[model samples]
Target: MTATMRAVVLREPGPVENLTIEELPVPEPPPGWVRIKVRAFGLNRSELHTRLGLAEGVTFPRVPGIECVGTVDADPSGELVPGQQVAAILGGMGRTFDGGYAEYTVVPRTQIIPFRSDLPWEVLGAVPETLQTAYGSLTVGLDLRAGQSLLIRGGTSALGVVTAVLAKQMGATVLATTRREDRTAALAEIGVDHPIVDTGTVAEQVRRIVPEGVDAALELVGTPTLPDTLAATRVHGTVCFAGMLSNQWIVRDFYPIGYIPTGVRLTGYSGTSGNLPPEVLQDYLDKLADGRIEVPAPTVYALDDIRRAHADMESDQVIGKIVILPISGQR
Candidate 1:
């Protein structure tokens, strides 16, 4: 192992230019922690929030990545053998400590999920966090059942596309939203039955299709569209707040009666590594390998292109997940 590795460090929150690459010492794992030789990591809106100074509890000089896939480099506890494929996700990653924006990163054993896959690093990089959130939202947040109807508020997002895929696999009818008319094709390819253009308010459009509204709705766009999302659900149906792609999550001056409609339930989903059972991830990967499902095609970037990646994510011009391959030649 090299004594030093390349890492993108955010000295302080400001702009994409704040993300600068520097050679830093390879982090050594402490007793219960494991060091991973990072292959690739995904660019998430959460990391973008941190970089824009919008995220809470984040300190400066951080390597801001919430999810990564790689090989185990060192494990003092011997729970995992060296060179074993593993993934680490959001348990204070990129906030409380340095995260996966580097050649190597050290995370607590609990945050690690081990798996085996011959898939390329880019595809593997897009799975861990995306699958965890989508699967958790569907199962835990909404308790989605087969034949139920679903609406995704931000269908063009990586999370939205993955959720749609999972929902379809579970035998649900899906209605997803994208602000751009052109991106509707992307949603339709994933089996989304209805792709409604999000003209800031989509409840009317959603009702036009489902009439009584969808059986469930996933709110990825945040609080601004949350009210409309709630209105888009049928009685006794659920709306789960999962992502904050809009970066404005809080809803002030609380009033439940006027806010929530009769017999409708509102819930939120934020998952930990444990929320995603290993078998679930392995099953999804196996399905992917055999062509049972597809992840939204990712927009790939090399480590040197971190700034441009962040810029693209912030711009919202890109349709799917933005993935960064810190290691060269992983493609």
Candidate 2:
């Protein structure tokens, strides 16, 4: 009898009902590919877009996940030992092929980032993609430096909070936004110096706090608020467009000469796992182990509860990243 693993298969994009958990044969890794015994995975908006059919170039009957944390089960190349902790992310995961929403997943060796972590799998699961995007946004997109003033739009989102934590660590005074005033406390816990309740006039509200505007702004709210985000930055300041929580990325009309503020630069970040250095990941893991830093607390779900998980994610009430534990009772 062939070994089988439980996986979530989405036959077609439509609603949350399309995600179904089923038993499937464990996949084998060819030469150049590695098989991972998935411990846990993070739910991302990228997967949600794929589920809604808003994403491009995705095929049906896919295991939709962009990132997973696991131990190496097989590496035909013999470079990775069995049970070595690793994370697989991006590089056309879930979209181009079967991804991490399973007990086992196979990916090209290039997609894997190896690290040693005694942290709980649930915690580790949330780190890969979230850290990759946040760290890359700070370093590559914004070149954020110590003692700068930074603002994070959509501050309650998973990426927002992670960026806030990282910005504070970099010695930047952080201002972040939450849609609800009650969530301000959550932002504060993550070291947000100012938590503005976004009522669509974030630029006005931000000026009231910083006067000359922030030294840098991280735009995660999508194009609807991109203009206001630009207005909230100081002269020569940068805004890195990273997330599309509003699902409105396009501006419809292109008039950047008139639209962008004078001396304010706008860049975007959409990097893969390889963009994040391995030592950076290991250092963050070590900090988590030593309690020097923290990742946002995640809402964890078992693979069996994928439907509810997607429902929760779509509802947008959760404040942090959502994670899936493929093996029940793992953490």
Candidate 3:
């Protein structure tokens, strides 16, 4: 391979205008890492936040991507061979370290999960972050069991859809909420039993649907709906705060004393805590292969169209994960 390859780099912390295509040196695999010829990388909302200087601890002139699907080019040990399809989930990629927004990337071997040949590249890129986060939060954080009820905030989000699908497959009743009423049917088709349009009365509607209240809630939207989530949760129910899409990471004005009266519990979920093990990832991949869970492909863009891809993601115009193809390829 050539010493240099094309990549989208964030020269400064700013808008999409700050991102530009450049020929950067190809990275080599470290001891426990593998170098991948990235076919596609998924664009995440956090990437945009990092670009806007909202994400804490990110550095300048970085490649911004967290999830990737590619083929192993070089493995220092015999653990993996060249041309094998793989995917990864880690914080440094696109933030503190060079990410998959390039022609090639270096990922830790432990972080890399192999994908079946039957799975498409775009779908592979979309799987790691969303699926791992959902599975970890639902299974590890909440201990969701069969026949239980689940409430997912931001039902239209990629993570939300994955959570709903996984929960339904595990025999749970899922109730989801979205800001757009038109998206309710789409969410319902994804196995959500109750899809609530986010009017001012979301809490009231959820209470009416499950008068006893939901068994658990997977909260992706932050403070804007925290109160509603609390109100909809059943006595002794649990709420997993997974994401802060509303940009409200800190909750200073709340007392759990009120929730104690209702016997409710609130816990934060983060996927990086080793909650999503290789076995669980393999299970999700197997489900994908067996046609059990389907993750929809978002709009595909070329490497040069990085700005347009970010714009589409930030505007919420896209239905699913946005994929960026570094090399020319079809859907």
Candidate 4:
């Protein structure tokens, strides 16, 4: 008989209250898949957006975690040993398929990346989605180079901060912007060279540092802030749109010919298995293990308090990622 486990289930796209901790049947992985006994998982704004029906193509009665850290509980492929530690994400997790918002998540073998880390579950859980997105947007979308100047339009965001830290590691001069002046010091702590407060004229502040503007800009604030991000870039520089923190997706009044500067390139990136494959997840894990880059300790919550967790994330009060430990009583 199949066992049952604790899972945070979203019955519909409505409110945080829609997500409930329930006893669900343990999933048996299909052929070429494995069952992972989830230790921890990180939460994202995308998941929040999905719960509110903002994300398209998400079906109801869904599990909402996009990434997880756990052990291979059952691997029929014979490639992985039982109890082997691993991390899994991407491949339509929590979107098109059952995901990691549970005590056990059944994911495809192809999506699993063998990882061994001594770090606590919160830190490991925080690394997968954020690091994969940041790494892809920087290396794949922007192709960031050493000595170049980078402007992170939404620098105070979790992805923005991770990207800034990684860019600094790659020898880039990073300039960051935040709507709140209070976040300036925090941004600076993560190696942002210039933490400017944006007051409708972020380009002006950016131009103050580099007369022609920075070499590249990553637009994490979405279409509402895309113009300013583009304006903050040098003539030949690139601007990548990776997030929609402004909660705006389409440009209402778009004039591509006029809005786009001469010789400047605009690119949009979304992280997925095709763009951020499982092997890349392993690469990021290796980096974390070796201290090449670090993910901050996540603000943790019990799986039972998931409703409060969603409220906290939507409040925009928390700075870093929030983690969910399915085993609520354990530390």
Among these predicted structures, which one has the highest lDDT? Answer: 1
* Residue pairs that clash (backbone atoms under 3 angstroms), model 3: 65-94
Candidate lDDT (C-alpha), each: 0.93, 0.92, 0.82, 0.85
By lDDT, is 1 or 3 better?
1
Q: What C-alpha lDDT, on a 0 to 100 scale, does residue 200 get in candidate 2?
A: 89
What are the root-mean-square deviations of the candidates from the true structure over C-alphas?
Answer: 0.8, 1.1, 1.8, 1.9
lDDT of 2 by residue, 1-331 (tens): 2499899999999899999999999998988999999999999999999999999999888999999999999999999999999999999899999999999999999999999988889999989999999999999999999999999999998999889988989999999998898999988887899999999869988889889999899999899999999999989999999999987888877798899999999999999988978999999889878988875679999889999999898888799899999998888
What's model 3's TM-score?
0.94
Model 3 ranges off by over 4 Å: 258-261
Candidate 4 lDDT over 17-63, as tens digits, reads 89988898999888899999899998888898888899888887898
Candidate 1, RMSD to the unseen true structure:
0.8
Q: What does the lDDT come to for candidate 3?
A: 0.82
The digit string of per-residue lDDT tens for model 3 on 134-219 reads 98889877889999999998888888888998999889999998888789888888888999998744768888988988999988
TM-score (C-alpha, index-matched) for candidate 4? 0.94
Candidate 4 lDDT for residue 118: 76
Candidates 3 and 4 compared by lDDT, better number: 4
Candidate 4 Cα outliers beyond 4 Å, as residue runs: 274-295
Q: Which candidate is the best by TM-score?
A: 1
Clashes of each: 0, 0, 1, 0
